[model samples]
Target: MRSLFFFAPLLRPHVKRFALALLLALVTLVAGTALLGVSGWFLTATALAGAVSFNLFAPSATVRGLSFIRILARYFEKLVGHNATLKLLSTIRQWLFGALFPRLPLPDRSLRHGDLVSRLTADVDALDEIVLLAIGPLIAALVLGGAMTAILFALLPEAGWIYLSSLLAAAIALPALLIGVTRGTGAALVEAAASLRAHVLDAIAGQDDIVLFGRKDHTAIRFAEAGETLSRLRRRQAFATSLAAAAVTALTGLAFLATLYFGLSAFQAGTLSGPILAGLVFGVMGSFEATNAIIRSVGKLGEASASAERLHAIATLPSAIREPLRPVALPEGTGIAFEGVSFAYPDGETVLDGIDLTIAPGEHIAIGGPSGAGKSTLLALLLRLRDPQHGRIAIAGADIRDVGLADLHARVALLSQDSPVFFDTVRNNLSLARPEATDAELFAALKTARLDDTIRALPRGLDTVIGETGTTLSTGQLRRLCLARTLLAPAAIVALDEPTAGLDRETELAFLNDLPQALANRTVILVTHAALPPELALRTLTLAHGKLEATV
Candidate 1:
């Protein structure tokens, strides 16, 4: 109920169409049942008249006219129902995508490829059936049930009473039995789906390592287990769904028998005509099918409720970083000050304590720290990925929180130590920093990053398609490309984290050789364990055991 209730706003735009479709279905039921009753009477009257040598005088054209009405009603009613459902699907898809966008930055890092894909695609597929499976049939059953009872009451009240009572019993039992059966399956299915996604992604991402370590068989076993587990869940859900459907069918069949047994007795007592007797059976069949539709709808609500809960969980994640509601503009000149800044993760064991620092615009500073000394954490705060738990970090004498997030990011271009290389062409990867950069500019950055020779030697030069995560490129080449990308960015403030971490001696010298030309005129903050090379004016700061002290 909670999840289904939350989903109402998503359906607001299509409510009019939904209501129209329901009305059309009502018109269809009334017209269809009435046509069946009228045609039966017309046939019987024509037959009796003919037996008296006057059948040729009966109006056969009346039955033909009513048959056409049934055809038109069904066709248009189905059209309206399908059209309304299609519109609702489009709205639901938009909501799912829109709800997840704001949470992407600090997204569940634990999230894997398959899990995201399933939520975006497969979960949506489940919902398409839910619309009709829940509401449409419920309304259809009520309308048809009441209509049949009204007709039956006029013919023989006892027969109508017996049949309607049984129909009502099925309606009440169908949902209650289903709720008991599928009570615990939804949460389990959701977890199983997520786990399968994670396992598949893990196997693919580690394919290279798996082959080298001779662990392919191990991964296969794990994947098989995950697949089998999810399969069992699906089978159980399906079994429960089938069982409920079967129960409804059996109950409706009994109602039909009860109507027939009692109707025959009424006809012998002259309480019901021959045409009315046949009409009662026709009405019961029409009525029960509508009732059965309602029964199936109850099972569908479980699925919708489950999906809605998952989607809501994603939408409600507290934003990791909160920007100022009334954002201050970025000031001129890029000086930064870290004033008595102290930090820790959520549990509160310190990562950086009592840290303080300042750097003027265009001043190149290298921050050297032992491992786990808060070097990367400091840089992350400077880039505003996470704010300090205590103390203030001001940029150009204005607190970073006071500035709009977009403006702060635009002011600082982060060249992360991991310096991830996307598996795009050399030119395409380089152009991410400045999308309008020309071919000549790209070649210039390539030369400065020492990747010009490698690009030229390739068969397609800059158009080479580096495989996934730069698997086709060496570590040194990947780092140089990452540096080249940062060179093309238009920010005065650039922060580099261990840019030379995995480089060879020759590659290291080449990177430093072109470093000045690439880093010229910018306020650069370099995170490295070693000293800055001789080519740049520099200051040094050291952080050790979560404490910072100037060591220039």
Candidate 2:
């Protein structure tokens, strides 16, 4: 519950809309109760008059007026309330995305892709009930219940205490009890639903592997288990809600009977009129309407609370890397230096140890090694994706840590081993590297990566929309497409990790042969196990056992 309050600041801008909705809702309930009371009074008095010189003008007009007001107020209340809730939801999504950007490359891998999607979509959606369902209805119940109690006191004091006690029990006690009973079930339901979604996504993503390994049946069984867990929790929560609602219904009946008993005693004592007694009894029935909504919303309160806690956990995680307090400007050259750099993972597995190296501006260097040699770790360090455990990495005599990450990244572009070809147009994918690049420049990069001719033959050329992960393209073509994007960046340095991964030997050699001309005057750091052509004039180094050694 306290976690839910963490987002209160986001509600400030939309408070007016919510407040107006609340006002209309209160008016709707008041008019409804008044309508019932007035109609009863008017009917009873008419029956008693029996054509005796009775003036039915005022009561009849009021009954008609209250009914009309009730209808209009209810309509506007729904309109305003839903509109405000949607706008609030939009703001929350924007805010969540904004909060999410700087925390990229989250350190916690326990949060699967599908689970993260659930938090961003479903969990954020559950918060809508905070205003429209829970808070609004609870306030309406309090105000209406209090007003009804006061009227009973003024007109028939004997029933006032009875009505107030029943109102408190129905409006406050039962709802509280419902929240307590369903709290754990509601939380379990959220987790169960998220787990089910994760299972479905995993199955879809790994269907090919599951089939190859003959584990399709196992996967299907797992999905069924997740579904069953979600269904059972939902049933449990529904049962709790129904029980509370039944309790409220029984209490309402008892309150009515007790109120009637006192009203009758007062009437027999000649203290109460028949018409007034009927009106009060009818109003008592109408006042309990507010509690119905309260009871329903109480069941969702626990779900909302759990969702809030989940969202808060993700948003508050400490960033993997922090920006410098007072950043220094990057110097003029691209000369790189790694001075006494050492790094180890959280489990104390050293990947790089006391590495020291330097390269002059415009140097083309290749580091070749077996897998798990920490070649990619070196690149990540250079890009400031992770800070080194010890020592400094400098470019042009400026410590990379002392410069702004954005500025440092702007100067050094990386094409990682797993660089993705987004589900978008070839033009849009290339534009990610340089949004303002002209079509001619885009074509130049593609041609350098040896992919221009293939793209030119596509149905829409640069306007073609590619499938997710570039499924429409061949593996080698997708790799080249990503390479084209990296080469298109306007950085002074280019870092390529396994650039020739999916290419044929002929294409790989051709790409390496064209590399020097394609990246003229820019420093290049290439990490791959591919053999370099002798004529390329590139310096080579090898990494083994947490150390770098120059190749003979």
Candidate 3:
């Protein structure tokens, strides 16, 4: 029930369309049942009149009018319902993606990319059932069924009671029974779907490792196991759905029998005319069609509930770094100061301890440390990706926590080893820094990062598409592409984390030799294990065992 609240705001703006669609559905179903009753009653009355004194024109016109109305009503009903459904689906996709974007930086392993993708695509898709299947059907069934019962009651009271009782059973009690039967199954199905998706992704991502370790067979078996588990859950859910449908059908059939029995008795007593008697019988049969959606939707409620719960869990995650209530504007300087900065992971291992450091505007500093010495953590903190457990980090004499997030990000740029090179046009990837950047600016950034030659050699130059994860580019090219993107930003401060990693000695040395000239006047923090070049004017610092030591 709580999970359904996640869609409150998402569905609010589209409520008008939803209401219109439901109205159209009710009209379509009601018109269909009325057409059936009218045809039955008219044909019987016309046949009787033909034997006495024929008047065919009026009855023929009425049947034609009802037929046309029925056809138009059904066509428009489908059009409106489908249009609203598609629009709602588009909005939900956008909303869910926006909500999940900022939460991607979770370093604590609380979320997985595969699972997130599943939630965004599969889980979000499941929510459509709430609108199309559940709510829309419930409204149509109640309105149409109630109105038909009232009409029957005016004509034949006993038949009306039977119709109302059976409707109540099908529309209300049967749905409850269906929901109870499939209550836990929905959650289980959702979990199984997510797990299957994760397992398939893991197998694909680790295919190389699996092949090398002779575990390919084992991986295949595990994937099959996941599929089998999903299959079994779906089978149980389908069975429950079928059972619910059977119950509704049986109830509807019983209502038809009761109406026929009562209609015959009323006709014999001269309380109801022959035409009206046939109308009541056919009306009861036709009225049950409106409840078809109710039967189908009852089973789906459980699945939608599970999807909602999964999506809500991700949407409500608290930010890792809390934003200030009133953030100060960043000053017009690049100097950074870390005052008694200390940090520890969620597992309580201290990564950085009381580290104090400062760099003046336009200064370049290189940091060196062994693995696990928290060198990269320093870059993360400086960028405000995570707040330190203690102490303050300030940029341009203002605490980062007190600076607007967008402003702080604009002032500092990071080119890390793990930065992604997306599968897109060369120009488009570089333009991520500044979308409005001109071609000349892109070329300039490319030249600065020494990647212009590679782009020029490509078939389409900047317009050429890079394959997935930039696999089309060489290792060195990919690295330079990421560097080019970072350098394209108009940031006052730049943090390069192992910037030249994975490059050959000559390429690495060449880039390092030209680094100072390329980044002239920018405050730089370079985290690397390489020895500093003699020509560059840099203050070098080494970190060991969670402590920083300066080396001249």
Itemize residue pairs with steric clashes in candidate 2.
none
Give the better candidate number (2 or 3) by lDDT.
2
Listed per model in order, the count of residue pairs whose N, CA or C atoms clash below 3 Å is: 2, 0, 0
User: lDDT of candidate 1 vs native?
Assistant: 0.76
Candidate 3 lDDT by residue in tens digits, 248-344: 8898888888888888888899888888777777778888886778878877788889898888888778777777899888889999999999999
Q: What overall lDDT goes with each candidate model?
A: 0.76, 0.88, 0.85
RMSD of 2: 3.2
User: 1-552 in candidate 1: lDDT tens per residue?
Assistant: 587677778778877877777776666666666666665665665565565664533345555665676677667767776787777777878886776654555436554577767666656665674655566666677777777877777766776787677667666667777866775676577768778887887788889999999999999999899999989987888788788778777876776676777778887888766666676676676666665666566655566667667666666776768878899989987899998898887766799887888898888888888888889889888877788878899989999989998898888998876777777888888888999999899888888887888888987888888877897778888888888899888888999888888777777767666666788888888888755567655677888977877775
Let me know the TM-score candidate 1 reaches against the reference structure.
Answer: 0.76
Cα displacement (angstroms), candidate 1, residue 70, comes to 7.5
Best-to-worst lDDT order? 2, 3, 1
lDDT of 2: 0.88
Q: Which portions of model 3 show Cα errors greater than 4 Å? A: 46-64, 102-104, 453-468, 471-473, 501-507, 529-541, 550-552
Q: Model 2, range 368-401, lDDT digits (tens) per residue?
A: 9989999999999999888899999999999999
Tell me each candidate's TM-score. Answer: 0.76, 0.88, 0.90
Clashing residue pairs, backbone N/CA/C < 3 A, model 1: 50-55, 133-297
